[model samples]
Target: MRAVAIAAAAAAAKARRISGRLHATSSVRQYSIMISPHLKNITLTHSDSSIYSDDRSRPYGQPLAVPWSANQIRFAKARGSDVRPGNVIERKGKVYQVVKAQHSTQGRGGAIIQVELRDVDSGNKVNERFRTDEIVEKVFVEAKSFTYLYTDEESDSVVLMEPNTFVQLDVPKHLFGDSLAYLKDDITVSVELFNDRAMSASVPKRVTCTVVEAQVPMKGMGATPHTKKVLLDNGITVQVPPHVITGDKLLIDTTDNSYISRA
Candidate 1:
């Protein structure tokens, strides 16, 4: 009987030890499950940091380059004949847009390229001659939509705003030159921006303006290509057909400043 009691006691002690071991294992598993979500959150935070690290240093929502400027190409000046109209070139730290390019070879000199260029910032026209071996830096500019707000009489500048964001900017009047005659309140124009500054503004190809003053047409002049001088509401003078009269709204081509038709 004594041996059986001792055997029973040993069996009971073994059972208690086994139960304690199982309880410890279950506690460890519960701890692991509880910590898994925190670990996952930490990993996600690291991933987000890596993804947006570059963006944090740039302007908000601003791209590295203009979207429409992707096709812009740069050409090194190798020959005078290589320069073409509509090319923008940089010289003496000033930018100029080429309006016309003509290559000519003098009787005694090397080939010379004559280029008529318009100053990008001042809208002034200049004539330049370049040698075939001279180096020129070609630049490309991109245009954006801007709304005409008003002309600042004090500064002789035009005020414009972005169409979508309404960001306002003031551009020099000379940048528009005679094109300013076509500008009206609330008119939208294509503005070329360079270095975050307005370089040029282009009016629509055609615009309607009221004829504020028109001279009486000469009857005998009908046999010839005769046009009467008329003053527009914008104070610009243009030639119009004989039939047009005062208060007549006429369509005008902004490119050549020629009359198109009656509007």
Candidate 2:
């Protein structure tokens, strides 16, 4: 009878130990569930794919999967020698528009490429030097036809509308900078779109503008083809030939804002 009592006490202690282990497991699982959402948020905040990975110590285990429907930019890998002026490129995770690219070969060195870049969104300028064989990421943008609407004074943006769908979009003034002086209503302009966002706008290579005001040629100025400063209807000032006068229509090069000829 005593042996049976001892066996019963031992079985009761074993059952208690099993129950404790199951309770601990349940508590651990609940704790993990509670913390999982916070961990996910932290991962997303630090795991943006656009960030450049330069540190070797930090391990990015695997790339996050991107949806197939997401917009993807077209890019090509090319050497620094192949980059051209007016091309867009990605460098150190920043996008820059190439203003000018020059290649030179020195007597002692193999070759070098110099590039002047402007930050697409910040309007900052930077000069970069690269070896001829250095690789670069060249981005391609698509040009779409858009008609000039009116400038939004409140937002300080130029409004443009698509012809086919009449979809209106407001482009930041800084995107075109001084080039906006050439924009005119009802004129068709080319807007460079990247990832469905307007990156820049190009005015017609040649535009006709009426002379709103002109300074008369000075009498004493020698006959060395003296030029006079004239203001166009768009408020841009340019030097025109002495023959140009008020109300005269003149052909101007929008690229350089220079006088071309009498229209």
Candidate 3:
């Protein structure tokens, strides 16, 4: 019975020690939480801090995400005719892909060019507007020649193969809709790859197509033109001029999918 009592006492002592250690850890956590406000103010900007607070009107801060700055973006070449979509940009030593570009007036403000960029690694897209003359980074892309092999029957995806090589890749048809519009047999496209797979594609500046079917012109149509839509051979339909008819070739601006004029 004496030995049993001694064993019980020893176990109780160990438990007390563990309890003391846990209390010490909790006290440290509380201390850190008390000092966190000052640390946050030092580390985060005013806009960033506002995003973190419990204010419903402010933007929410993404936790544990790396911050990217638009000012750090560097342009490789001068802003000219070459500033087009699918161009990779290097900013703060990281790469981003340009998805779309639009220039518009900001309601009584000067013209601003809004750019949509997709993170090359995460495939996340963000929008930012800048002046038309603003310089941006243009990162070098490594693309190789490849050819379309066939479409997947089960998954509804198009399979591609490298020319003179047996390597093959399968991509969704929806993701390649724009490519399929002008993609011809054995045509070449600049494919941007991430982790050994094609993540995005870049096409030519402009392409010309013959209007298979054009609607009769709706003369004196109101503010909104009487838009009669016609389907193209690529399985895409777009509204065109009423004067256009079947077999009339037309040049289209592929960027905006807008009709230019009769070819």
The candidate that achieves the highest lDDT relative to the unseen native structure: 2
Q: Please give the RMSD to the true structure for each candidate, in Å.
A: 19.5, 18.3, 21.8
lDDT of each: 0.72, 0.75, 0.57
lDDT ranking from best to worst?
2, 1, 3
Q: TM-scores of all models?
A: 0.66, 0.67, 0.43
Task: Report the lDDT of model 3 for residue 133.
Answer: 71
Per-residue lDDT of 146-184 in model 1, one digit per residue for the tens? Answer: 999999999989999998998998988887868898889
Better of 1 and 2 by lDDT: 2
lDDT of 2 by residue, 1-263 (tens): 99868855755564444334432312222111011232221111122222323333433333222333353447889899898887888899988888889998888988999899988778788999989899999888878999999899898888999999999988877777678888887988888877887766778899999999987766786775668789999999999888888999999999889999999
- Which parts of model 1 are misplaced by more than 4 Å? 1-79, 121-125, 218-225
Greater-lDDT candidate between 2 and 3: 2
What digit string (tens of lDDT, one per residue) describes model 3 on residues 1-263?
Answer: 99868855755564444334432312222111011322222122222323223343434232322223322333465452345677777655666677888778888777787778776656567887767676766655457667766667698666777777768876555545365576656655556664465556644545566666656655686664555676565555667866667776666666667777767
Which run of 10 residues does model 3 get worst, by summed lDDT?
26-35
Could you tell me the C-alpha RMSD of candidate 2 in Å? 18.3
Stretches of candidate 3 off by over 4 Å are: 1-85, 89-96, 100-115, 119-124, 128-139, 153-157, 171-180, 208-212, 217-229, 239-243, 260-263
**What lDDT, from 0 to 1, does candidate 2 have?**
0.75
